[model samples]
Target: MDRGERFDRLRLARTERVGPVAFDQLVKRFGSAGAALEALPHLARRGGADGFSIPPEHTINAELEAGEALGARLLVLGDDGFPPQLAALDPPPPVLWTLGDPGLLSKNACAVVGARIASSAGLRFARGLAAELGQAGLTVTSGMARGIDGAAHEGALPTGTVAVLAGGIDDVYPPEHDNLWGRIREGGCIVSEQAPGVRAKAHDFPRRNRIISGLSRAVVVVEAELRSGSLITARLAAEQGREVLAVPGSPLEPRAKGTNDLIRQGAALCEGAEDVLRALAAPRTLREPDGRWDGAVPDDEVDAVRDRVLALLSPTAIPRDELARGVGAPAAVVFAALVELALAGEAELLPGGMVCRS
Candidate 1:
């Protein structure tokens, strides 16, 4: 894609109410960012937008300029250097604003997520595991927060690492990690789905977690509470078919409950990097670049099927297979419809593709 096309893509992504899924569907159907930008307002209106508007051109332009001024650049999904694993996601972000060496994205990677207030043992384990993974030529990725996340990045720093920021790539949150953020920017990679000037909102953290999981072949949770963001990332990793490994923590520690629960629910138990490596050694489980888009439905047929599926959904969530049967549509068509409905903000695709009127 050319600069103008990328600019248009960014503009579409920055538009209000245009989430990742919608942006991707529009791009796939239109075959160009320019066309998608042209189509968005009409699509929104049809999908029940009272007033839809794309983000102003100058807003996007200024975002790009801000990034450039900070020595960062916007990296659209499918761009030459975007992470292959991330590109394979069902609805990858249209673009990621990045700083430092985006080249680190190409390296084999694993994610380590855990509590910001992790115990001393958990932090020690994270650092040791990260170093071992780094020694094996895997680039350890983390959120670069405090505790386990910080330890993971610091351990992998001598080799390589990647930090997926919840805020803009240029905006280092927590303030105290300023020096650590600088180190990663110089020697590793920092990425964010939001534009450069966007502040990290509460909702942005889960979105940030997905990228941390998506960029890696596997995700390791060092310590996490039941409601922790790290657990959310682990669930997303599992849904993505990426290996999820969790270090067993004592039952007494509330922070360990999430990881232990994951282990009980069939997530791999990781004592160390060797266990993770062994699990990854299985022939067909690790994601192959060639297989990323192997089974995706073709773009041409999505919209027609999407229209049919929307009519089946109601305010209550319904099982996809049941909806497919009720609507007398093929499973794939129902799947595409749910995806489109999700993109259009007419429906929500819950875990298991359960569709609900939105």
Candidate 2:
């Protein structure tokens, strides 16, 4: 992409309601970010948005400058050196703000995650497992939280590690890990999908977990309660077709309940780094890039399709294929309409290819 196109893509991403899915759809449909920007208002209006507003150019420019001032760089999707594993995620982050050595992202990686209030044995096991994985030439990845996450990064720091943050690349959470954050920048990497200086919210953690699991070849859960965020990461890993491995713990311990449940659900039982290495030996295929269409539907036909698709959608989530059938339109057309609805804030695409009214 040219410089102008790059700026346009960033501008489009920063626009209100333009998330990863909408960004991808706009780029594919309009063939360039500049063209997409030109068409956004019309599209949004057609999809029932009252008035569409494009983010001012100065806002985007200021964000870029802020990231640069922090000694961090932005990695837009499709840019050279962007991690292919992360790119394989459905609705992959449209952009990433990264600090330290971004080169660590391409290394063989495994995620070690567990409870924030981890047990002594869990912390020791996580540290040892991370050290072994790093010694075997794999970069360890994790959220820079307390307990198991901290131990895992500490152990793997000598080799390499990547911390996928829930907030901005520069916003340190928990306050106490400031030193560890600095150390990570010195020898490893810190990455975030949010714009620089944005503080994390409650919802950002689950979103961050997906990126952690998406970046790694496998995710290991050391100790977790049944409803902990560690389980969320393990579940995302499985959904992404990455290996999910959990250390079996005693059934009596609450912290072990999640890992034990994972093992019972057929996630690989991980006693040590060796178990993870063995699981990694199996061949796996990364998700392919989304297909694009060069043909364009006439404006009237697109309007009709949108109306039909909208009529079929309800507050309850429905399968995308079923909605397409109900609308009597091609799957791609229905998908494009759904993307418009999403961009207009009228619909939401849930996990498992389901959609519902927003």
Candidate 3:
């Protein structure tokens, strides 16, 4: 798009309650982010958000300047050189800030992730697996946390690696990774959806995991506990239609539970590079058609569905399709009302067709 439109996209992304799904709805409905920005206030007002506010233009300008100052590039959704794998996400992240060779973002990639507090064997396995994957010409992707993630990047560094961070492209947590971070900035790539200098919050890790898995053709869990971020990434990769692979670990080890459970649930067993290659070669389930209407949506249709949609929703997330069925409305109209509700800070639209109370 044009310069003005690019600025508005960043602004809308930074706006409160305008997440990936809402961003998609607004841009698709209004035709462009510039138009979306122009209509945002009225839309929120109709949804009962009288105090809705847009992030200031100067704030967006400052963020752009910060990115430029760091020599980092901003890859907006739909921009040339934006990774097609990432862009294909149902509602892709609005922007990615990158440091180092941004070329890695679009490379043939597989994720290697496990526990941050990992066993030496797990770390060694992760490093070797990453190295083999790299030598086979696939770039390895990881979250750049301690243990397995750091080992994965280390092993793959000479070939290619991409670090998807929870913090800003510049914010390196677990401070000891400063050396590794520098190596990545020089020879690999560092990327995040957060702005420059933004420290990672607890909530950001799950969001960051989606990008790690989304950028890859498949995800491999080396070792993990019953509850860990690695499994979250695995689930997201599976949901996104990427191959899910897990290393079989000794049942005696506590960290093996998650990967073992993944295997039990039918994730392919990943023993070596060949298994990964074979898994990638396997056919995947076909994605469903992205249903949409042939013509403009009516304001009255949106109004008709709003209250029923509200009554059906609670803090627990429900599928958007269920909402449509519950309200006896067309999916398009229910989605429209949902978007308006999201704008009003009344709901949250999440990945994999989920919607929940704000």
Best by TM-score: 3
All models, RMSD in angstroms? 3.6, 1.7, 1.3
Q: What does candidate 1 score in Cα RMSD to the true structure?
A: 3.6
Per-candidate local distance difference test: 0.81, 0.88, 0.90
Model 1 TM-score relative to the real fold: 0.88
| Better TM-score candidate (2, 3) | 3
Which candidate wins on lDDT?
A: 3
For model 2, residues 178-199, the per-residue Cα lDDT tens digits are 9999999999999998889999
Give the candidates in order of TM-score, highest first. 3, 2, 1
lDDT of 2: 0.88
Backbone atom clashes (below 3 Å) for every candidate: 0, 0, 0
* TM-score for each model: 0.88, 0.95, 0.97
Off by over 4 Å in 1: 285-322, 330-345, 348-355
Model 3 bad stretches (over 4 Å): 285-289, 293-296
Tens digits of per-residue lDDT for model 3 on 45-90?
Answer: 8788977888888888899999999999999986898998888887
* lDDT by residue for model 1 (28-127), tens: 6577778877866665555555666677888888888899898997788768887888887766767887788888887888998899998999999999
